[model samples]
Target chain A: MKRLRTFIALAAVPLVLAGCGDLSNSSMSTNSGSSKSGSTQLTGQSTDSDYEGVIQSGHYQVSKSRGVTNTQDSGNTYNLKSFENGMLNVSKKVFSTKKYVFQEGQYLSSTTVQNWLDRKSKSNTTGLNPTDNGSKSASKRNPIYIQALEEQDYMTQKNNKLSLGGVTIGIAVNSVDYYKKTQYGATYETKITQAAGEAYAKKAANTVLKRLRQKSALKNVPIVIAVYRQASNDSLVGGNFLAYSTNKAGSTSVSKWTPLNVKNYTFPLSSGQSSPNSNDASSFSNFKSQVENFFPNLSGVTAQAQYDGKSLAGMHVNITTQFYSQTEIISFTQYLQTTAQKYLPSGVPIDITVSSTDGIQSFLSRTKNEKKFTSHVFNSY
Target chain B: MKRLRTFIALAAVPLVLAGCGDLSNSSMSTNSGSSKSGSTQLTGQSTDSDYEGVIQSGHYQVSKSRGVTNTQDSGNTYNLKSFENGMLNVSKKVFSTKKYVFQEGQYLSSTTVQNWLDRKSKSNTTGLNPTDNGSKSASKRNPIYIQALEEQDYMTQKNNKLSLGGVTIGIAVNSVDYYKKTQYGATYETKITQAAGEAYAKKAANTVLKRLRQKSALKNVPIVIAVYRQASNDSLVGGNFLAYSTNKAGSTSVSKWTPLNVKNYTFPLSSGQSSPNSNDASSFSNFKSQVENFFPNLSGVTAQAQYDGKSLAGMHVNITTQFYSQTEIISFTQYLQTTAQKYLPSGVPIDITVSSTDGIQSFLSRTKNEKKFTSHVFNSY
Candidate 1:
């Protein structure tokens, strides 16, 4: 129940550095400041594309260039400093995709996890006969990939009871790697044929299902197995995947398995759109780059998007950075919104949660239209 | 942003009656009774098709005929008495959909709102030209239809900025009616050609857009207008709707309007598998019926389901009753989940919230494969 209450944060990162800054804003004021009289009514005439139109009476002026400015008589102020800083450094990091395999492994060293598995195998050989024992545990080394994939709770719950009903299990067909080493850790080696990968993923998934069925609650849960064909060093998030489900005589026990149509399990923000089995890794990388470009000092960042079939439903982008002032956070949030509006197909709400290197966390949420913002600074750090 | 923090409850029903119940359970026990010695090892051999399998060591026993039975050494118990009561009288006021014109009137009566509009027109007259001024204050009679349509905040926000950037606005091609009167109070006679309905919905929607654009904050918001054809007195929840968007040259003002594919804006529980413009309404209705069937005294019920394009993202069901015991609530929740799993697409999280006529609110939530449930009861009535 606690888990249900706590919606998953966008990303998880290790503690790397510590920075300090208070969220105080000294410029907040309620007085309606009088704009400079006789100012030119730039009204749609400005050549600068960043021209943020003219401010109406009793409202704050939007700065074309960027800095905090209180143009309204009320306390409302337009802070563009963060936006300007981000724009100035827009080209610093161009978005790019990286190849990696999407699979589950605790983010332990490959040697460590393999050892753990060996020990478990020696102690209890009742289940978990890993067919792809031939393949190395390479995915364990990439913490981001591990976190992204493992966090998905594949089954659906009915009547308050958790079941594997209708969940399509995914298996990796071929070994994929992002690089020799990820920012989090080094990669392990893995190589398997497409047929072997399918056999391995399905077998691995069934092993999991078997364990679940042992429990009284999950015995009757329905599930499916899907195999994905991954190119060597391909992005783990996106790819064409095949689904296999059991043919039941009367919704009883399995009566052999049949292959379903090629279903796509896309990673969020990927460009592949809706391929039969794969996601475009390049699109997500570009999205990440664009996000990092807006922060003043981006340390490390992990962004995740959610898709319903091929339709992108929502996204959670967590940015890790050095100390950011309150104004900087606001500005960064605005910048992120502008970018999403430009790139993301509309109506998708994006949750931008920022965690400082020191562990301080803040959440900025935006939904299209209906001008209102929900944000909170967590001080537990 | 503050609005984002407050997720909408399933319904906003007016008080129709009052009910009462106490949250007491005299059946709390922590003893694990040993099974009868030499009992048949039902362990997987009972071919009784209704076999629910064995009970887990620390879990409760499941009754195939539906009754609460505790079989765990731990304090877990199967509270099925409530379930049985619910199933006994499943025909108690089944949740159904009502239809009304999807016009904006602040959910007030048509005549009252129109009169209000007339006053504003006489005093301000800056905008708001009422083309169809012949109708009186009739819509106020239909509260259910009004609440059903007005509560949808479909578009996501960027930061705190609400825009229609990617929301495909759905418009009904034919003016639909629920009956002679609606919950909010309306009885308007409408008979228009399909072309006329299209023209009216569009002009009305555009008028709304024009009014919104008058505000500086909403000037740059992007929106698409979708229209759907509905038979007179049809359910407003599901059906294929059409879409129309302007071809803006530079995200400024509308350049020219273009008709888009008939996009669907389905109400909960309708059917039209994943499509650009349809939803599965029947499934949701059945889910609702199954839920109501479990509750002893069900009053008014309002349920809503959300979809990302065609993929179901989540659902919110609010029920009003006289009173309920904790066990009864649990039974109802379990029934709801079971129905959802059987009917809904896998992995779509469902949020079931309940409100009692006595002014008590409870929320129970579950995600796939996650055994624990999140529930809290609040007495804010």
Candidate 2:
């Protein structure tokens, strides 16, 4: 707390510095003076060739140089020379990649989801093992429960156009239940209880798109959002349940809630355990089979599942979806490109133009040759 | 400890991400694929005028444009356009004043001396308060201590430089202490106490430096080593001690330690309290009289004492080094021009060529203006 107090005091002193001079007046006056000189000289000129126009085309590059200057006082003078460079080469690197679109009901998850959420919420719970019921620890005893009550909530969205290697992703975060706590007995509690399950599920979907951005050539693609609820009685050693609402074709409201079918599906549990060994495989497989029967045309789209690893460990379900049209894909791609260009380095630009067949073949050939050379270099190293 | 362990674990993962990327042959080979046509070109050419040059001139300008880049993929693009124009301008303001250097034999006293020492030893006893007797509380139960130890220490030397006017000025610090404390207890207990004190002292010095770095413009500066010890009772309330030392004459050591004079300086029992009011017509007048007696024959220098609505608190001493030589002044003007050019808009180059009289006049004018502006601003705000 003293360090925190020290930092607060340190931060407060800057206000005293801010009132020292009118930096704006100085800069504006300096700029005005410089502009006048430029207008008078008219010595410098720029052309399209000089600019390379990579920014317009959605690409970027990096370069460097060195220079010298003079310093003086009284009757003495000195020259100072500096050598400058950057850690990453700006010119050759890609700042953003082409876009990719996910079809209706399709989902993708990032490997970072489970780990990030777990670490972030580990201190919230009071239970010795929140994910393991056998631990027999009181659930609400941990500080995490209090923190969770005041934590912010967030959502994730897919944006593959700005990604390199055909992956695009974005997240929307919001504060939820912030600064609030529950009271029990004589103490007031303020901890995060449920570790942002909804946010992580959305994040998983976005991550897959990010990974695909670099490899895909599409742009301005559209994405569809699908929501699911985690079913109770799920365990790390057994199978897990997922429920979703489905509307009838004729009726747009008051749809029935359906559980996914798992027939013919064998879910893995830990390194050596299987759902079948726990005698829950039959039920999970039946649920999977039922979902398939409901959606017979679900194919061509990617599917991913997210779970509280501790509670629903080992068992992963792939709820597949349908593909999107070319027009929708293009629209989503454009949106992604715009987002990527906004944040990407000035050098790296997204390439949105459709490639010709010849161009694709040539690219493949060149890639093969480059791969061979790379292999040799790697082996030598 | 558990929280610390979790924090470290979370931090380590990000660091590992930096090294996980492998540039294998397979990866390199993939780079040859023909990207979108014309997409590989670099945009944004390097111009003679760029903020990087301006920053090297020792002047910091705040621009609407974000000065730092975030690599966390947070998807938030900073927009500087919304900030007021000219907000980032930094001007070179001069002060036609003299600086007084504290030389050997100058004496110092007051609560500030004790505060300075306490601050210097802060790191060793972090999270622990010093005892009422000014000894580290950790070993205060027993009394009667002696024996000097080899301690590392630092000293602060403030150079007259451009500052955001009206800001409080203080010394740059570097210090280390190596010493022993004797206890009336058993010899074994005495050894343990001394060892702890020495270790704590070293840590305290480092902590003080860390705190000092948070001060404006003092971060990352070179430091000098010094020897520190508790003041003797004879050097207390009415006593005096030498507070100055001489550097080795011919050696250009950046870290040369100098002894300072101290006398009649008593630690304040409460924060923000100063010495008893001077009996002179005015506190400032009394402070000026004392300064003159402390430093005789101080000509060609302007001195002023500052007060926080009480007794004299500190003094501002400036000395005129030399009149400018035409050639030297010209070179200095050119340096200023070049520095301005670096931050100026593209295609703008500043050329400064002023006669000796004009150059000197300009420097004096800016200095006077800055001082006047600072006084008015601080007084009003």
Candidate 3:
């Protein structure tokens, strides 16, 4: 009967874990690592019991207890918490829950981060030392994981050990939600004004810090909360809200947050749109590969991400091909748009130019919209 | 070994029958109806022996005897002939073979005509009177089959009794062949002057008549040899020479050929293209279905075939839908072109107009060419 109960819990794990898009079974396999003495460790015990208000802020709720992280051992006990802040009225809202572990690298692949988290969890649960697991070194476990959430809680888990020395919290306040009434259906408005939304974000960050101080195991971890904000709904990731972190001394130093930027982040486009330094080539390589797979006739693809120096403005793609048929050109362009939307920062303009055989050229431009939106096409043969 | 040989032949029958595209075993099952007391009957013997040169004209060869029409029955000895007229210089040439049978209906569906042939062959082989079989009537057996030949000698078989009372031949001269040389590849020049090609078509028609007269069975059958000439390579079917029949007097009267266009069959297009009274709504219904299948969102379709007083000229299609994407417009238009090309006359222009939502209009016009040709697109949005 207990074995059957374990099977049922395992079957329901995926559904519970799906709330956060990252905690996939294949990626979150707990790493068997050697343990070291003198470090405080905690293990999560999945429970069928629901716990509310574990992590709650303003209009957000992140700590919904789901039995996905449960183990076969019934004697184990685990504490979980989730916090959110966003919409007050509406059927939909965006809540981001961040689990900061001291790790290396500004940006780490999800698999790597999940490996670290797995190692950390395995070490605590099995009483095994991570150093004993020769597959990965301890130095690789000290990195930051930043996730952007919208419409749904798309948080996923990656495992790595927190540095015994300390923990750094990277805080990013994403897009703000607004209400709009339409005949078709009610929809959420994107970032309206940062000044109006920043107050909520700052208070949420402070609440997170206060909650962390209450935890005995995390009371001394150095906190680095870097807040990010979107200028408008259509803008991609917003500019940084001046980098601020807790002093090396202890959690007591997390009292004050300061702006890290020399000036307010803003880069204006010729079209009068503004954003941050969004031209991250490495970030868009995967998207380019997807485009190439869709259109094999493309001899070459050159893509540049647009930024206002504070947020992502849009993306521009120039392609060279031998195809001269207008239908083929249009089909290829639309396919590129469809694929880009899946991997790019939402609400940014996607501009593409196709140069084909016989000096034929075509341009397709589209952007996310509000008061006035226009999609334009230009062709020369 | 005998069973194996029979199995092998049956296995290969489908492969051999696929060249003409319409002679599927399932659809061509002969229906037997009551047989009348007296008619000059000749049975076909599906023999392993191949007899060549039954029909020959100019450099084109349609008389390449295939043993598929041979019979195993010794009493059955059906004589077949096919005369072709085209070119010998180019790698690709259009050759047309017309088999005039003493029957009813100037126009008959290919499948119906094939069923009659299959019935005639089966009756001759099994010695079963068609009337005794109670499947089809004698009236169904008396229809003339006209087949257009192109790249290859795409001709099958048919049989009927020659009316001893008298013979009438329907002559329709199809599109003429033109030639042009370009860097990409050599393309045919369209009809430039009918006078130059009509002489050749007339000679070819005389050759066919001469061949028919030489046959003992067909000697009494009145022959109508059509001579068609195209204005341009893109023209569907060409101008008709005329209808001529054997004199009621005898075979001696078959010498003179006359023009059948007493009123000059003229159906002028809005764009000034002249054609015959060609409103084949039923023939293009299947093609319309294909179009609808290609574009599910299509609201309506309008298609018309343009026929020269004698043969087909081209086709025009107008479509209405609520398409907002340019890719959809191109895909639908391309599908239309591909489907139309399979049924419409070669080299003829296909003009399509698509009316989409938001008052957007797309026009695609294309014509087959030799070396280098251009397709044009005009959009009003």
lDDT of 3 by residue, A139-197 (tens): 33321121221111122222322233333343333333332334665544334244533
Compute the DockQ of candidate 1. Answer: 0.01
Candidate 2 chain A, run of 10 with poorest lDDT: A372-381
Best by DockQ: 3
What does the lDDT read for residue A346 in candidate 3?
Answer: 54
Which docking band does candidate 1 fall into? incorrect
- Using lDDT, rank the candidates from best to worst: 1, 3, 2
Weakest 10 consecutive residues of candidate 2 chain B by summed lDDT: B372-381
Q: Arrange candidates by TM-score, highest first: which order?
A: 1, 3, 2
In model 3, what lDDT does residue A267 have? Answer: 20
Give the C-alpha miss distance for residue B61 in model 3, angstroms. 38
Q: How many Å off is the CA of A51 in candidate 1?
A: 47
- How much of the true contact map at the interface does candidate 2 reproduce, as a fraction? 0.00
Root mean square deviation (Cα) for candidate 1:
31.7
True contacts kept of each: 0.00, 0.00, 0.00
lDDT of 3 at B68: 21
Model 3 lDDT, residue B219, Cα = 61
